[model samples]
Target: MIRAVAFDIGETLVCDDRHWSSWADWLGVPRHTLSALVGAMVAQGRDNAEAIRLLRPGIDLAAEYEAREIAGRGERLEESDLYPDVRPALTALHDLGLRVLVAGNQTVRAAQLLRELNLPAEAIATSGEWRTAKPAPAFFARVVELSGVAPHQIVYVGDHPANDIIPAKAAGMHAALIRRGPWGYLWADDPVGAAADWRIDSLAELPALLEQHRGEAG
Candidate 1:
């Protein structure tokens, strides 16, 4: 039985792409510039410190981005109310007796993101706090341990296949890919190209999909 359901924040539960895009536009850089900065740092063998240094040009921009992101977050629910099915979908999973938690890449800002969205403070498990990011087995393992559930007993739903699906499965969890419409993890694997046990175009489809799994398990 599925005893718990873990989610990836950002693109999964709440949406922050608009804030990011606006930041990118304001900074006069490509939307993927931040992503490229991280990648360049890794490629140059500088680790996280170097990545931050490279992005120093936009230090002031960071505050503006954060302010807008936090202020505008959760203003309308999921992704500006564009995807109105999020709350209902989460409600259905909750009704199924599954423990819910969000594992996001925000590190220290994860909690802030949840708060901006008016999400319960306890629902988040962020990578920033742990000093690690997703797609790494250790990151997902931390959530499993925190949840007090075996990996196989949980379902991890995300919009990124690599960050969410592959690693979740590697940790022995069921994986589902949410078709994120332009509001996804910019630094992670593509949702469509990455492997997953199942893929759905909307959160509205999640309940029935889980029921199918329950049926099969039974």
Candidate 2:
């Protein structure tokens, strides 16, 4: 049976387009430019922050994150920031006695924002805090460690075919592909997605997925 459920925060639980647009404004580039940079970064198989560093050599990422965290602390995240299916799905999973957690490639400030949202996660962590990002085995390993279960007993859900699904599977965790975001739809047809344990359009579909998997495993 699946004992734990882990998620990628961006585009999975929360829509990150607004944050990317804000980054565009901060970088003094048109929002479309930032959006293009994101697509380019994904197309080239590069990390977003690394792409920014290469694209704009003088931008201070750390300082920008600090400013975001400061503003985030004072602001309350609205329900609109979350996917419509998130709360109900999380509640269903939690009531099913599964552990829920987030392992995301976000800034320290992002973690702070997550806490303020009162999500059903037992723990929410970011690469900035873990000092490693997804696609790195260490990040998935850490998630398994946090889950307190064997890798095979965990289901890791995310939008990125390469970063989230494939790597989680590589680490021996069952992977779920949620097709709702840039990476999700962008990477949908990748051969890697074919290896996912589940391909779902909404979090609302997850509870039944768990039941189906459990029955098959049983």
Candidate 3:
């Protein structure tokens, strides 16, 4: 039986329009230009950061991030950034007595902002804090360490199949593919996406699905 649920942040729990828009603004490009590049990268199965690199060739992203922070135009997360179903869905999981966690490829400041939102989660972590990113076995190993349960007892949910579903499954965790974001919808019908233990259109669908899992396990 699943004892815990961990969620990805971008386009899973949080809508990332503002995040990319900010980057476009910082790079002095039209928001739509950056947005189009992101979509193109997603379509090509390339890293999303490639879009930004394409905008500013040979740019050092980390240094640029520090510069943006110093300029007071760095990462910002607000309650409005969260998807409508996030609070209620997470609350329902918490009410079911499951350990709810938020872990994704985000920055330390993003983690702090998420905690400030006071979502119904036992813990919130990021790639920056762990110094690891998804699609990597070590990242999922860290996730297992954080969950404090057998990997099979935890269900990892995300909108990215390559990063979230495949790696989580390889790590022995049940994977839930959420079909919402660009990558989510674009690859929803792919065979790799079909490998997920569950495919959900919304987080609100999760509680009942987990209940069914419990019933089957019984």
Q: Highest TM-score, which number?
A: 3
Residue-by-residue lDDT tens digits, candidate 3, 80-195: 99999999999999999899999999999999999999999999999999999998899899889899999999999999999999999999999999999998999988998988
Query: What digit string (tens of lDDT, one per residue) describes model 1 on residues 1-218?
Result: 77788888756776555644554565567878855664465444344335344655446544654665676642222336334666677778777767877786764754554556654323677887888888788898898987788988888888766567778888999887777733233323443335677677777787788877888899
Compose the digit string of candidate 2's lDDT tens values, residues 10-41: 89999976777777776678888778878888
Rank order (by lDDT, best first) = 3, 2, 1
User: How well does candidate 1 match the true structure in TM-score terms?
Assistant: 0.70
The residue pairs found clashing in candidate 2 are none
Q: Answer with 1 or 2, whichever has the higher TM-score.
A: 2
Off by over 4 Å in 3: none
TM-score of decoy 3: 0.99
Consecutive 10-residue window with the lowest summed lDDT within model 2? 68-77
lDDT of 1 at 126: 80
RMSD of each: 5.8, 2.3, 0.6
**Backbone clashes in model 1, listed as residue pairs:** 107-128
Runs in model 1 lying further than 4 Å from the true structure: 25-82, 116-122, 182-194
The CA lDDT at 111 in model 3 is 96
Which 10-residue span in candidate 3 carries the lowest summed lDDT?
186-195
Poorest stretch of ten by lDDT in candidate 1:
73-82
* Candidate with more favorable, higher TM-score: 1 or 3: 3
Better of 1 and 3 by lDDT: 3
